[model samples]
Target: MCFGYWLETRGHQVTIATHENFASFVRQFDLKFAPIAGNMEEFLQSKQGQRLIAGEKLKKEEGDKLLLQQLESAWSACQGSEVIIYTPLATFGYHIAEKLGVSCFFASVLPLTPQGCLGF
Candidate 1:
């Protein structure tokens, strides 16, 4: 939501696509919201996702597969963005930006330290 606000303040139109829960939250700010494919809640409730969240180590191939799924989910909605800016965990947007030939920027607004208020 802050990202959308920043871009809007700078006179750029922004449409955000994310999990449905997230989309619902951002719509309160009056930003455009599109639902990214995949049931985030269901995924979170799944054993695999739960294990990952619980900090089970991931093999490189497993990690790559997860990233690929995210990329596929984000692809269609990213179609018309002139440029893409993504939060750190948004690995999907990087691939979409590349495929669309748009500039891409990645950032993590949350502090990396363990004691930081916004962990993710």
Candidate 2:
């Protein structure tokens, strides 16, 4: 969210594609909001979510289905975009950008290195 705000301050048009629950929060920063499927609160209360919180991985088929759903939602939100900026969790953005014939950039709020520090 802060990143989107910073980009907007630089005169770039920023649209934040996230869960529907965050629409109002994104709008608070004056950034365009694109709805992504799923609600965090509801998910957290689900059996699958509880399993994940307990450190158990989903079965392959379950994981694949969830990934497909997220990809579809993300693809829908990204239509007509000239560029895509995504985090590690949203690596599907790269594939979407390729399909759309657009440029893509990777961004992350977390440390990328095993050393727990950014090289730059």
Q: Write down the TM-score of every candidate.
A: 0.72, 0.74
RMSD in angstroms, candidate 2? Answer: 4.4
Clash pairs, model 1 backbone:
none
Residue pairs in candidate 2 whose N, alpha carbon or C atoms collide under 3 angstroms: none
Instruction: Please provide, for model 2 over 21-83, each residue's C-alpha lDDT reduced to its tens digit, 9 standing for 90 to 100.
Output: 988988998899988777866777799889988999989886676677778899999998988
Q: 68, model 2: CA deviation in Å? A: 3.3
After superposition, the stretches of candidate 1 with alpha carbons farther than 4 Å from their true spots are 57-70, 109-120
lDDT of 1 by residue, 1-120 (tens): 675777787899898878766876888888988776666677768886687789897677755765565667678668788988787667767877988999999867575555422322
lDDT of 2: 0.82
Candidate 1: give its CA RMSD in angstroms: 5.2
